[model samples]
Target: MTGAVLAERTEMVDGAPSALAALRRGEPVVLTHARERHLVIAAERVTGRTMALLVRYSSGFACVAIEGERLAALDIPLMEADDAGREAFAVSVDAGAGLTTGISALERARTVRALAHPSTTPADLVRPGHVVPVQVRPGGVLERPAPPEAAADLCRLAGLVPAAVFAAIPESVSEPLPTALADLTTVRVEDVVRHRERAEPLVHPAAVAPLATRRGLLTQHTYVDVRGGTEHLAVVAGAVADADAVPVRVHDECLAGDLLGSVRCRCAGDLAAALDAVATAGNGVVVYVRGGAACGGQPTGVAVPADRDRVAAHVLRDLGVRSVVLLTDDHGHAGRLSAFGMPVVACAPLTPAGQCDLRAGAVE
Candidate 1:
């Protein structure tokens, strides 16, 4: 695309916040990638009414996008054993109870909810069922930044489970992003990147120290942000700016879990795992934000506020890190890193223990 065309397209998108607001309010949104568009709905919010809309206008096979680790937690495996396929399709499933058949719109909606629920387990789902769950390819939108990844990213931004129900619209890529699809908000992937890139993250470097720890000699960065007025830390292991697909972990503060070693959440374990990965990687970073807001008041540290995520992104950029492969502790969090031009090439689970139950802080 020409520069003028790119600029015009950028103007058409309002980006994450707008889409996030609508999703939080239980509304669907149009997510665009390249020229193709898809109708996306939060998995938890999918209803009979919305299912009908997707079925009529979208690709008939509506799929729910989720983190691959969550799939393992529920005893679901990728459709392909080797997981070499690009589609990222996993074993299909349906709600295990309260439904006679899985083909109905309402039934499929229930299946989606089961997938998104934190308390849901393998027994709560039946394999080879009506609803298909597609794993979000790590680094989330930062990795691919396509419709599927964007759907999951938007859901996460709304402080919901990263699972999303999305289906391709019949619309052609040459068409303009719709301002109204039954009044659903529209967000273009590139537009979100531009929106984030419009300004630098609001943070000022305060201090740096060479910290000697068990992992090795790691550098620590402290930043004071005027907006949040919080002291955020970025611990570095060796040189990263010159690397590609460098490992990065954006850890939001969770005192109760990280400090107290509370079994109530996996915050502590995830943090330790991240530290281990960075130390071993020899070229990585762990960005820590203070006072993280849990998703829906849940104790999980998975959801980092969009602004804080942006701060982490800028910190990485300042460190000279180019593209990255996210070293995620739990859930599917890529944040708005890709938005600021710091691409997340992939997401790797540091250890199998961290991969066990994706929702460590979830309650029934």
Candidate 2:
């Protein structure tokens, strides 16, 4: 059935305030227009369970909306808890004129799916002042149409302000959601944006334990950003090779490749190469950044430039190293460390064996 049939009963719609409260309490709300239906929910309220329900109810993944100003106030812990949540959290926007409004039907459909499965954050659908990322699975681009109008209508009918819209499968044929998310509803994206909280601080690092990998014995160090209330890790291969030019890599965390051995990205290989390079050199530091959870689950790669420079530098300094020979693929890090007077080396790609494809003793 199409959303038109499901949303035909316009009289049953609830007030905006109650709908907004339902969203805060983790409910899925169905909003309809002439022929469109939207399953709207707040980004802050998204959980793995709710995500499952949203996807199941809509017969596809859910989309997310966030106000511009509340971007920084996003719940990092919540974003990192689920893979799709991370993808949704990564979409960015400026505000106002920059907001995305107009789009071809095909383009909107593709954008919604892209937002769900991003390598980095997708940038095509620019919605000024708000960041809306949808939880769509890839490869069914045309399966669901974008609900731009329905999102706006729902927000307007519910008396809620708009931020970004996450397009989901129409619930025309779906049954009422279970009790957990029966009230999946929303409030003014504006109110949530206005009442958003600041990120917690990252205080200091604490030593974990010595972990022995195939390469060698390594000491693990964990630092909690108490203010940000997140944790970061540093894997030390061996004694410092040189204080002036210590080999170091600021690696971003990847759930798929690093842990699950997925080949979608080279993160796993990159990480192994970094560790091996450091091990071969018999010294150096590999700072594995929990960039996602630590910084509110933004997209890895370009979206988050691994702003762990200060943390990496701190680790080196604490190890009695004054400077570093930075190892990385991202030019952003290369530039940041170079400005700080550290020698930088843009990392070469790794061979299939997870070894650096470089001439003997070359990182430049």
Each candidate structure's TM-score, on Cα atoms with residue i matched to residue i, is 0.54, 0.37
Residues 242-271, candidate 1: write the lDDT tens digits: 787788887767676677756665667778
Q: Which stretches of candidate 2 lie over 4 Å from their true place?
A: 1-203, 293-302, 340-364
Error of 2 at 337 (Å): 2.4
Off by over 4 Å in 1: 1-12, 81-85, 172-182, 192-364
Residue 346 alpha-carbon offset, candidate 2, angstroms: 8.1
What lDDT is reached at residue 303 by model 1?
Answer: 49
Q: Report backbone clashes per prediction.
A: 2, 30
TM-score of 2: 0.37
What's the alpha carbon RMSD for model 2?
21.0
* Global CA lDDT computed for model 2: 0.47
User: lDDT per residue, candidate 2, 1-364, as tens digits?
Assistant: 2223222322233345566556445455665433545566444344445455555656453344432223333311223333432343444332222224523222333333333222324233354323344333221111122343234333333444443244454646545645554545533322221122111123376766898989878888887755475677888777663555567877767665578865445566778888888888877788776654211122233433424554454445455555555665445565544433233433333344442222222221
